[model samples]
Structures are given as C-alpha cells and as structure tokens.
Target chain A: MEILSLNQISPDQVVLLQWGVVRITATLLYTWVVMAILILVAILVGRKATADTAISRWQNLLEVVVSSIREQIREISQDEPDHYTAFIGTLFLFIGLSNLLLIVPGYVAPTSSLTTTAALAVCVFFAVPIYGISKNGLAYFKEYFQPTFIFFPFHVMGEFTRTLALMIRLFGNIMSHDKVIAILLAVTPLFFPIVMHALGLLIGMVQAYIFSILAMVYIASVTQAHESHGRGP
Target chain B: MHIDWFVFAAQIINFLILVALLKYFLYDRIVKAMDARQAGIASRMEEAERLRQEAGRHLQEMEEKKRQLDARVQEILNQAVRDAGAEKERLLALANEEAQESRRRWKETLAREREAFYDRLRLTSGEIIFSTIRRILGDMADAALEEHVVDTFVGRIRGMDEQAQELLRRSLDDSRSEVTLVSAFELRPDQQEKILSALGPFLSHDVTLRCEVRPELISGIELVSQGYRLAWSVQRHLETLEEAFKEALREELPEVNLENAGGEDAPAQEGSRQPHQSG
Candidate 1:
C-alpha cells in the first residue's frame, strides 16, 4: 500500500552511488528521467519544424503554445519578452508537465516533495538576481535598497521568504493532495479517492500556476521597471 | 524537511536542460515563423496598395483622355455646325443672286417684247393707212377729177414763190435738162399741148418738152424740168390728209410711220404709177 507514496516522499532509494559516503536520491532520478523525456520529445518535434511560409501542423501548435507563453511573459514583465521567454516558458512547461505526469498510477509529482520544490525555487531565486544583474546592471540592486538603506535587510528577507514560500506552498499543496488520495484509498478504496484524484489534478495545475507566477513576480521586481512591473501580486 | 543540496543541483540542471530544449524546439522557430508570415502579409499589402495606386492613376488618365476626346468631339461638332451655317449662307447668297439675275433677265425680255409689239403695231398701222388711202383715191378717180388735177397743178405752178420759180428757171436754163410731164390718166393731144404750154414759162426756150399719158399715175400730173417737179392729184390730197393725221397721231404716240403712210404707196401695185424725170 505504501508503494502509492513511492514518490520522493517515500523511504529512501538510491541507485547511482559514489564511494561509500555518497549516493543519489529518487527525486534526482525522476527529475533526470523527466528531463530526458522532455528533451527527447522536443528534439523529435523540432526536426519537423518548418521555416517556410507554409508551416507543419506540429509547428503551428508549437507556435501557438510558444506565443501564448511569450504573451504571458509580456503581461507579467510589461517589457519585451524576448530575453525572458526561455526561462519563463521553461518554468511553466516543467511545472505544468510535472503536475500532468501525476496521472500515472504509482508515479508522484516531483513537486510532491519539498526537496524538488526547493530545487525549483532555488533555481528561480538564483535566476532572478542573475537576470537582474545581466539586464539592468546596477539598477536591479537599487530595488533592494529602495526607500532607505535600512530596508536592505528586509529586502533580503523578502527574497528568501518568497522563495521559501514558493517551495513550501507547492510542496504542501501537492503532498497533501497525494496524501489525501492515499488515505482515501485506504479508508474507502473507492469513489472518493477517484474523485479526489481529479480534484488533486486541478489543484496541481493551480499550484504550478502559482509557483510560476511567484517566480515571475520575483524576477519582474528586479529586472523590469517599476511602472511596467505590475503583475503577480 | 528531508532535503539534499546535491539533488537540488541535479534538479536545477534538469530544469536548465528542459529550458534549452523547449527554447530551441518551440520558441525560437515559432517566433521566427510568425515574423516571417507577418512580413509576407505586409509585403502583400504593400503590393496591393501599389497596384491600387497604379490602377487609380490609369483610371485618371483614362478619364482625362475621355474628357479631352469629349472636348474634341464637341469642338468638331461646333465646327461642323459653323461650316453648315456658312454653307447655308453661301447657298442662300447664290440663290438670291440667281433670283436677282432671273428678275433682271425677265425685265429685259418683257421690255424687248413690248418694243417688238410696238414695232408690229406701227407696221400694221402703216399698211392699213396706205390701203385705206389707196382705196379712197381709186374710188374718186374720174375724167373731171383729172381735169381738175391739171388745173390745180397749173395754178400751183403759177402760184409758185419767186425762189421756187427761180430754181425752176435755173433748171430749164441747163442744156442737159429736159422737161417731162406724166399723168395717171391718158390725156388727149390738146391736153398735152395745154400742159406743155402751161409749163413753158418756167422752162427755157430751147429745152425740149416730153409729155406722157400713163393711167398708173393715179390722177396726178407730174411735170419735171431738171430736178424740179410740180403735180396735183386726188391721191396726193389724200396723202396730205394722212400726213396731217400722222402728225396728230405722232403727238399721241412716240413712234409712228408717217412717211410710209401716204403719197405714192397704194394697196394695188399697178393701180397707179408715176415717174417724172428731170436731168
């Protein structure tokens, strides 16, 4: 029965190892597998992409999805989405794909564990500063010291807290939904678990949306101008 | 929170790989295609606009040409109308000239016809008067009238003015002159001698005297000495009356044949004939 919790939330399992002191976790393995799958599919679909006036239907689908992502990024940043498309679009694809992959029977959403959620949050945390420094030069740092120099420590806390909140929120929501389903499977073993699975899917998508939007807010706060940075409260 | 920093690093690597894959396969090509399609549509729109402008220019040119053609047509029509008016005027002038010339010719023909009619009337009147006088004098011819004509002729010779008598006297003095006496009636030898004796005073003594009796003289006696003549007859009296009538008619009519209406002319050619030879 605990095989249902066979996500990273389950007991430890490490296949790849380095000497006696080092080891790998299920979270890293699952992440690498999903990453490989995504990359392989992207490469295969990319082979059929057209550059001429008449485009393949597959290319059209890709264009619509990418353009939607660009439009979303533009709405969030209010500046040009030319540079931010890769990061934001990937953030959306990874989270959304990770949530959608949960439809597999024994598979766990990677965000169901705090370790993977923390990893994604950490990536956003580092990406915000790196993008800010690269785009606005010294102006990005000014947002941290805004209003007064005394607020610098508070700005630092806000950054850590927001990243922590993103990780915790995604972990709690996904984990609780899976836990609820697992418990329902034990107690009822019937219709409610199935019903909760559907609800959990809906919550998974919402949590992915929240996580990406929070990341966009953090990045927008630094790299984008104040007047243009109005999205993702 | 059972978290491993090592696994976090691995997940971050996984996320980066996913971003690179999605960007290469989806975002870059899709945006490029969209941009290409947009550029194509813009170029097509520009081409369409250019074609539209060209068509507009062509339409304007055609309209301008049509306007010019219309103006030319109007000018031609006006010119035609003007030519027609000029032709009408010319024709009218020609017709008027022809009408005027015709009227002048008619007037000339009428005047000529009136002159011919007047000439014929004069000729006819002369013939009528001559006929009537000849008939009247022919009806009055008798021996007594003949004796009276001789007496009157002798008395007329006796009553001659001095200048007339001297002209007669000069004629009789010429040696080449011969005295001739003619009568329309036959005269006896006694009458002939009497007529010759009566003319003896005007004639020279050596001048020969010739007496002739001719009924064609129409009751007149003609005595000629050189170029001088003296005679009296009923035909002569009637001729004198016809001359007076012709003079009266001459006052009423501008053209009358007075000379041809009287004297020696008669209806019958042989009814009277007289020739008096002097010189």
Candidate 2:
C-alpha cells in the first residue's frame, strides 16, 4: 500500500483516553458531560418537589416539562396513567439532552446515527410487548397469531417491518438535519448556518417528543390487544 | 455525508442502556405515585357521598319531628275547642232547664196569691151582707108580717099575662143584661121565690121561698128562673179592680224574677188569712 501524505489525511481526528481496561472517546466525553448536566439539573430541581404546591422556579419549570410528558404517557397508556409516566419522562430528558448537544461546536446528536436509533427502536420493540405481557401475562403473546392461521405469516412480517420503520424514521430525520447544517456551514459560514442550526434545534425537540410518544404508544397497543383479537399486534 | 460506524454503534448501545435504565428505575415510582393520586381522589369522592347521605337522613329526621310536633299541637287545639263547645252546651242546657222551672214556679205562686186575695174579699163581703140584711128587716117579728107582704107582691105579679111572665123569666135567665139598682140594704132573697115569681105562668106550678145568704152577692138580690140565676155583687167589682192591678203588674215586671219573691209580699194579715183555690 502507498503511504499517503499529510495533505491527503482526512480532517477528522480522534483522541483516546484510557481508564484501566476501558477506553473513553472524545465523543463519549461530550455525551457524558451532557448527561451529567441533565442529571444534576433534574435532581436539583426535583429535590423538594411536591404535588400540592410549586416548590421553586426551577422546580415549577421542570414540573411543566414533566407534566407534558406525563400527559403523552397517559394518552399512550390509554387511560392507564399508572403504567408509563416515569419511563417516558426519563426518555424525554435523555433524548432531549442528546439532541441539544448538537448546538455545541464539536458534539453530535446520538440519535443521528442509525445504530443509536436502531438500538432505541429495538429496546422499545422488546420493552413495549414485554410490559404488555407482564401486565396481562401470556395473553399478549397469544395475540400475534390473530385473524386466522393463514394470516400468521403476514402478521409476523408486519411486526418486523414496523420496528424497522421506527428505527429508520428517527435515524433519517436526525441524520438529515445534521447533514444539512454541516453542508450549509461548508457552503457559507455566515447567517445561513445560524438558521440551519436553529432548524436543527427545532427538529431535535420534535424528534425527542415523537420517539418517546411512539414508545409509549407501543406499550399501550399491546395492552389493548386481547380486547380486539381480529387485529394484528 | 461521511459515515462513522463505530460512533453509531456506541450511540446505539448508549440509547438502549438509557431506555432500559429508565424503565427499570423510574417508571415503577411514577406509576405508584399516579396510582396513589387516583386512590386518594376515589376516597375523597366516597367520603363526600357518605356525608351527603348522612345530611339527607338528618334532614328527613328533622322534617318528621317537625310534622309530628305540628300535628300534636293541632290535636291539642282541636281537643280544647271541642271541650269548650261541650262546656258551652252543658251550661246552655242547664240555663234553659232552670229558666223553665222558675217560670212554672212563678205562675203557681201568682195563682196562689190571687186565690188568697179572692178568699179574703169573699169573707169580708159575707159579713157586710149579713149585717146589712139584719138592719133592713129589723122589728118585723109578727107571725106573717114578711109573708103577707111577699104574697101581695107575688099575687099582683102572677095576675099579669103569660107572655109577660115569659119575658120576665127570659130577663131573669139572661142575668148579664140586668141594670144595677140603688139599694141601701144588702139583699138576701131566696132563689126559689125568685124563680116562682119570674116564671110562674110558664111553669103553672106552686113556688116556695127559701133564703140563702151568699156573700158573693153582696148588695143585690139574685133572681133565678128555670136553671139560671141573675147576680149583682160588690165582690164582682172588686174582682175587676184586682184584674186591672194584675195587668199593671204584668206590664211593669218584664225583668222581675217573681218566683223568688214569695217571702217579701206575705206580711199583710189580710193577704195571709184567705183560702187559696186556683181555677
């Protein structure tokens, strides 16, 4: 192989840090900082929170944000508000922090990667019906071979396709927005980039909402399965 | 755009771990909180319903007690009114019975008083008549002196016509049409002599004289013919005067309770000495 010159090397660079047997990357360092900030803020604001009265300004703001997530969870749980409040609340916070990290100079949206979105989708796919099964027992699994024996193949394929669809949808939207901002910065380094960055911010928040709501919906759909046997999971 | 598989793979792992962590640590607590809230709301609603039912029961009890009190009060009032009515009726009945008994006693007392007055008048009139007749026939002790005079008068009256005798007998029989005659002595003529002289022609029979002293005929002779007698007496005039006095008393005594007045009016000896007989 011909050795390439310095001019030919890619602009991308990597710096690695090791702690014992573990290696931490620059990207992971950014992710950790974002996570740490989110956690500290969440805990400090929620320290003395109560259902009866507003605790503080920060606590009240956090409560408003959490209440919206709780509303979506309630909808996804289909009036079973007891099932998904905390799960969806945490999901919103994590993804929101990850998406907001994109505003930083060197950080990227974790959800912009196919692997990350796929992993999230897979967790949702497995967790949704698992909770459904746990809540309703083995009755959830029995709902898969619905309609008739001849329609079983179609139903099985549909489940795989739906989960794949969730992965692709989130990955595509976040990746495209990141790419568009990068491309705009390369073309013009001025006001155009600022608009694209703002758009990225908007899209990021929307994607977080969509993903968390969809996961909650998945959990709800399975719980409603036994009531409607003719429909597929 | 450039692709970075390693970064993508790490992110995918990170997202999966986060989702799982949240599901494990956070969801259970949130669900518990939500369930607790729901239970509290349900309990509050149940408590409210219980209080409302209790209030309704209390209200009904109060209403029932009020109704009972009102009915009891009304019953007492009605009983009192009925008792008052019965008392009024008893008093009225007693008053009416007492009034009727008093009226009967008053009428009996008045009749007794009238009979007693008439008896006293009759006794006084008899004494007057006996004294006056004795004075008028004084010194006629000869054996046929009064008989010769009566025979001469009776022969002259008998010699008249039979139609004249029947007229005299009719006049004597209708004593109410006789006029009063002026006489000093009280007359005590026999009813038989008067009848023989008055209707001798019509009877064509012998007549005899038998004197009878009647105090009711005080100053006039009474003539008798057939089954009738003609009478004129001072006692009759006194009876008219007593009738006038009784009429005046009746007119003046509209409000008097005369049934209780018997002890007041019996003090005079003249009023006490007479016999009482009521017609």
* Candidate with maximal DockQ: 1
Computed on C-alphas against the true complex, the DockQ of each candidate is 0.43, 0.11
- Could you tell me which residue pairs clash in candidate 1? B184-B215, B184-B217, B216-B272, B216-B273
TM-score of 1: 0.57
The CAPRI classification for model 1 reads as acceptable
The TM-score of predicted model 2 comes to 0.46
Looking at model 2, give its docking quality level: incorrect
Q: Output the number of the TM-score-best candidate.
A: 1
Candidate with the greatest lDDT versus the true structure: 1
Residue B50 error, candidate 1, Å: 11
Q: Please list the C-alpha lDDT of all candidates, in the order they appear.
A: 0.73, 0.58
**What would you estimate as the lDDT of candidate 2?**
0.58
- For every model in order, what is the number of clashing pairs? 4, 1
lDDT of 2 by residue, A99-188 (tens): 887788756665665655666677677777778778888877766766567777886787788788887887788767766776777789
List residue ranges in candidate 2 displaced over 4 A.
Answer: A1-23, A230-233, B1-279
